[model samples]
Target: MRSIQRLVTLGAAAAAVVVLGACSAPSQEPSSATDVPPVPTVAAAGPTTPAVPGSTTAAEVFGPGCASLPTGDDPGSLSSMRLQPVAAAVETNPELTTLNDLIGRANLAGPLNAAPELTVFAPTNDAFAKLPAEQRAALEADPARLATVLEYHVSGTRASAEELRAAGTSTELAGGQVRIGGTGDAMTVSDASGGTANVVCGNVPTGNATVFLIDTVLVPQA
Candidate 1:
């Protein structure tokens, strides 16, 4: 009877072992298909935004544009011919003082300022003094003669040295052509009488005219 009991206990132990092994076995296996990368897609096109246009800027004017028009601090910018830059130029240049006075006497102040543009060939004081005393006395007595002689030096346009070179002849207000000659600083001009006026000072711009201080007076043509 003891042997029969022992055999039954061994059979019970073997059954428990089999049950534990069944519980330890895996229920699922790993997937065989590898994860594929997501497929790339093209970006969709959209309506483009319009660009802004560019703008233009206006010119700026500073201070007083007409500051040089009257009896301002600027010497050569005055509108009155007597008070104009030519006056200052002659006043300051010791050699041209007599010419300055002559201009005043000839009553050229108003006309010079009234003109839109003019070129003046200014003769020096020495040039006038170099004239014979009788001729000088004669000119002083006749204002019209003095005026005509002064007008002979004036052109209707404000011509620069470069402009004078380009055109050999510039018509004078006295109804004759003044011949431009030479080049550079040595440039000279010949009057209708063949007298040469050397350009002592060139391109002196005024409120209404341009002046070139010359060493000799221009003799007008008949």
Candidate 2:
């Protein structure tokens, strides 16, 4: 009986060892998880400004002659000129009297006022007055010839001083072209005949056009 009891106790001990082994997990090294790459960061862009169209560049009105123009509601003033069409605006400025008369003689007043957009390289009264009397009278006598000459001073599209510089050349309504050279007050407009003119007043806005008062009259190519 003592031998049988000892055998039974040994069997229980063996069973307990098996149960403990089964309940506990086997010793194992921790798993090394995959190393995920970090997401890339992006930066935002800055805002872009739009370019102005034609003479509407609205950049600024400047030039030596700008100082002489009247201020406020006077039609000749830059502010007031902006309110009138090209032809009507021309009538208000004393300096533009000769130009206005030439426009009438050329039968261009109607066309000028009707234009949707334009850039006029207008000669000051002195420019016209400086011409030989005979030549001026001859030009005035022939309206058709005067029209061509007047149209030569006009560009189909409006351009500011900087715009003219950027383009290097401008096409005229008369089918001719002018070469632009220099910057600001030094800027020069050279015709096909080699005649060059300097802009006195620039960025003078009309309801439908921009005018640059030049010191010399430009002629188209023959």
lDDT of each: 0.61, 0.79
Candidate 1 lDDT score relative to the true structure? 0.61
Model 2 TM-score relative to the real fold: 0.74
Superposition TM-score, candidate 1 onto the true structure: 0.60
Q: Which residue pairs clash within candidate 2?
A: none
Best by TM-score: 2
User: Residue pairs in steric clash, candidate 1?
Assistant: 76-85
Q: How far is candidate 2 from the true structure (C-alpha RMSD, Å)?
A: 32.8
- Tens digits of lDDT, candidate 1, 101-149: 7767877654554554567777766568678899888888888888888
For candidate 2, write residues 2-26 as lDDT tens digits: 2223333555687789899988968
Model 1 CA lDDT for position 127: 68
